[model samples]
Target chain A: MGNLLEIKNLNVQFDIFGAHVQAVRGVSFELNVGETLAIVGESGSGKSVTSKAIMGLIPNPPGKITSGEIFFDGSDLVKYSQKQMQKIRGKDISMIFQDPMTALNPTMKIGKQIMEGLIKHQNLSKNEAKTKAAELLKLVGIPNPDKRLDEYPHQFSGGMRQRVVIAIALACNPKILIADEPTTALDVTIQAQILDLMRDIQKKTGTAIILITHDLGVVANLAQRVAVMYGGKIVETGTLEEIFYNPKHPYTWGLLSSMPKLHAKTDKLLAIPGTPPDLSDPPKGCPFAPRCPHAMKVCVDHMPDYTKLSATQKTACWLLDERAPKVDPPATIGVGGE
Target chain B: MDESREKLLQVKNLKKYFKVSRKDTLKAVDDVTFDVYKGETFGLVGESGCGKSTTGRTIIRLYEPTEGEVLFDGEEIGGKLSTKAKKNLSRRMQMIFQDPYASLNPRMMVKDIIAEGLDIHHLVKSDKERMDRVYHLLETVGLNREHANRYPHEFSGGQRQRIGIARALAVDPDFIIADEPISALDVSIQAQVVNLLQELQEQQGLTFLFIAHDLSMVKHISDRVGVMYLGNMAELAPSDELYDHPLHPYTQALLSAIPVADPKVERTRERIILQGDVPSPVDPPSGCRFRTRCPFAMEICAKARPKWHEAGKGHWVSCHLHDDGLKK
Candidate 1:
């Protein structure tokens, strides 16, 4: 499969009160054609910043892509002029936000919102756009698409609003879809429906997805490959099984063991101690070293290199070093009563 | 699981309705009943607009119930009471709000925020004693004493939640109503708060009415859980029984909807995606509230409300599918 989008050493910085906060620090990943890649992280981990950078949505004054290359298809999106990027944004690569209501214009009808992209990018006529809008709504599993097209956003339920947002994102049929916490604002059952719709659409359309979320359960259901981000850096990149079962970094182990399993009774969760790093004054060593249970003297002073574990697994942690102490993960790290 | 355990709080047929207009009334919580044991964590879980939060708020008397009764420590707290009795009830049953950012007053220092309860209850004798108690509370919630001088904005979300916990503990309440306490926090930080709550429960022997939308976490911490749907309780059972063998169709759908964080399990597990969104609470479906989206819904399910029946040792379910009389 050909690479659809590649982010090479991407770095994003925000200037506030004469201080530079490094939001995304030297992150690199690739999205294969028709594959779903999930970037999992907590709030302020810079997952959103990296996605916004890809879409040319970063504000220059406060937020800037300090260094990096966003390669879409064979061209670099970073070098593209505003005029050129505008043409490619919706037609080639589109994005969905966390909140559906904010993403949509409440004053406008749902049909015109979906058709706006069709008319702008594809240059379709008003009638052609209207027909396509209903088809898009139907594609996203909304019942009575023709009638729903005439209704305003406020008339729709939260889940329906999200489906309409998905319809708008899919209107142009972009090759790469970036969904940033698309289901965070929804209920669990509604979240399941939206995830199902995304999977079903991907199967029929073959559109590659870059799903950015903090929920590991959503990642397990959707992503083929996983990239774990912490304090604005990619700590680990692996296949789904590798990331979940044979996780290398301590941060990944902390995230897995901390979760309260549904089918089992655990007396205590192995919660990572301390808060996330402050980006304005980020740690000098590993971002996770402060919270890691097995931190070493070397880990506090230096950032380790990415140690390749398998054909598709790589992690950045000093514990993976050949000379470092071999420590087994806590027994609570496995999933689903394993 | 023992029947001999003392019930700390009893909520019987609690109904809270909000009048949206002159004619229309939104039944946020209607006819809900449950009991919380002396030192147990009773979890209330459901999707948004399912009335779990409203149920908690009603029990805490944040919202006046339209009907039904609430008895705390065997004393009726639903109707009007003396000023002294109301104050005592407020101290005994404190509430921990969900959003720490919005719950804490931004202008106040951490010391004053934690000591507000102490000052309001007149528990402290002097300013020195108040500061001492605040320092002790900060330490109890895993925060340092130095944090007492800081403000809410200076702390992280996790730290702010710790402050909130300290504030709740300052009054030394026996029963705390924590409504979605960990929902607004990050994943790693959520575990921190849950562990803190568990540790505090053990140390203080405090009862918790933990209301949240996260089923997995609820299962882990709750001794028993009540599943609500569209302003009605669907099922009530021990956490293990509810997760392992769910009886209500809505509960089954909800359990299956939660994506387990395991690729192998996710690939093989059969998911039951409930059709359509939760119906509006204002004009909820008749008979069984979940009948609109239930896969096994029968004609009688739409005609009559299913009686709450005990199917196992303590597992209670309200579903036509489980009602022996209806099944026959």
Candidate 2:
């Protein structure tokens, strides 16, 4: 299948106190049709900015896509105006947010909210939209769809509200769905349910998904391909097995070791010792050099080039260089980089 | 692990209810009982609105218990006490809150925030003594002496949590109740806080009632863990045993839902996705609170509440499925 979305050299910046902060710098990745791709990173790692820039949701004055090419359906979205972007947003590529409570309008009925998307995107009449909205609700696994349509957002629970949000996003049968931290606010069981629902929906509709989250477990469970982001760049990109089992980047090693695994018995988690860099005044070298345990002199002086390990896996790290010292990842790590 | 160790805190049938309205009452923590041994970490895990935090707060006497007994160091601490007695009890127990930004006082310097417990109990002889003690505590929590003079806002989320820990340890309490302390921090910073807590437990010989929703961290740090559902204890077992052989359906579902960092295991494992959201605590199910969402619920589950009984050595579970061969 052809590529559903292509983000080439995407750069996003934010203005803070007269200082320009580059939140996303030169991030590039592609998503094929009917595939699930996850963007994983920490708080200020620019994963969210890449998703926002794709949908033209980056605010003006402070937030701007300084440069990039976002090609979808053989068209560059960067040149599109607000009106053009709006027509393509829900119809071609829809987006869902982290918090379900705020995503929904409190005063509006859930039925009307779902119907509004259909009425706008499909240009359907009131009755047709309402009927289609009910079907969408049922597709997202909402019980009592007919009765739930009349209830307001306040009446629904947290997980149910997220399901309603998903229904709205899928109202127009968009080709790509961008979910940013979809289940961060939910409990584990509820998070599992929501993830299962999204996976099931993808199988039935073949809609490409851009799952933006920091949880590796979620990425492993749902995403077919994973991109690890750090310091506003894609530090590593690989299939789930390559990322989890054959990771090469030092930051990826640090991330994999830091998480407390449910199945493993470890006394202390290996914490990467240092904070993320200050984006307002970014440093010259790699963003993770200060915290990396295997840092060499070259990693301190300049950014590493992308080294391809296989046809589908690549990482940006000095440690992957052939001439570099044979410093293996600490023997403490459970998987990857033997 | 230390079965003969003295019980530092004992709660029996503890209940904390809030008057949501004139006609309705919210059972925040209902008929709960547990014992925290000296120098051992006891974990409490549950979903939101499941009353895990309320259980911790009630144990620390932050919320008044509606009906039950709390025995501290073998003395009943349930009813009213004298001013001196209450003040002394407060010194023996302290709390570490979840939100480091909101918990620390913005107006006060880091020293005063940590020394609030010392000031309340008249621990210091002079201003210099208090300052020295605060500086010493700053070093204990991996911060420097220079940070003692700064305000809470100056520190990051992980550093702010260190301040909260120093405050909880200022009065030199024997037991600490940490309520979701690391949930607010990032993934990379969470390990720092967890390691600090482990070091403190070893050096000070402190008992902890760690309350959080993250089961993996809870298992790593806790000696014994308790699973609560709808303000009631569903299962209680040692850390390894509970994870390896979960008896209750709710506990099994919870353990199965967490995603391991490994891709092979995560994809191969069978995840038990519960049907719907957790039921409201105010009007919980008739018999078993988890019957509404449990996969193996039976008719008797709605007839009577299952008694918490020992299914194996050191493994206690409250479930209709675990009620087996008792007719013998």
Which candidate comes out best when scored by DockQ?
1
Tens-place lDDT per residue, model 2, A223-276, is: 999999999999999998888877888888888888877776887888888788
Q: After TM-score superposition, what is the CA distance of residue B148 in candidate 2 from its true location, in Å?
A: 1.5
Poorest 10 consecutive residues of model 1 chain A by lDDT? A329-338
Q: What is the TM-score (0 to 1) of candidate 2? A: 0.98
Q: Identify the candidate with maximal lDDT.
A: 1
Q: What's the lDDT of the predicted structure labeled candidate 1? A: 0.92
Q: How displaced is residue B22 in candidate 1, in Å?
A: 0.5
Query: B79-177, model 1: which lDDT tens digit per residue?
Result: 777889888988898888999999999999999999998988999999999999998999999999999988899989899999999999999999999
Which regions of candidate 2 are displaced past 4 Å? A332-338, B324-328
Candidate 2 residue-wise lDDT, B1-328, digit = tens:
5578789999998999998988889998888888889999999999999899998888778888899999999998888778888899889999999999999999999988999999999999999999999999999999999998899989999999999999999999999999999999888899889989999999999999999999999999999999999899999999999999998999999999997777778767888889988988778889999999999888888989998888887788888788874321
What are the fnat scores of the candidates, in the order listed?
0.76, 0.69
| Total clashing pairs for each candidate | 0, 0
How far off is residue A30 in model 2, in Å? Answer: 1.3
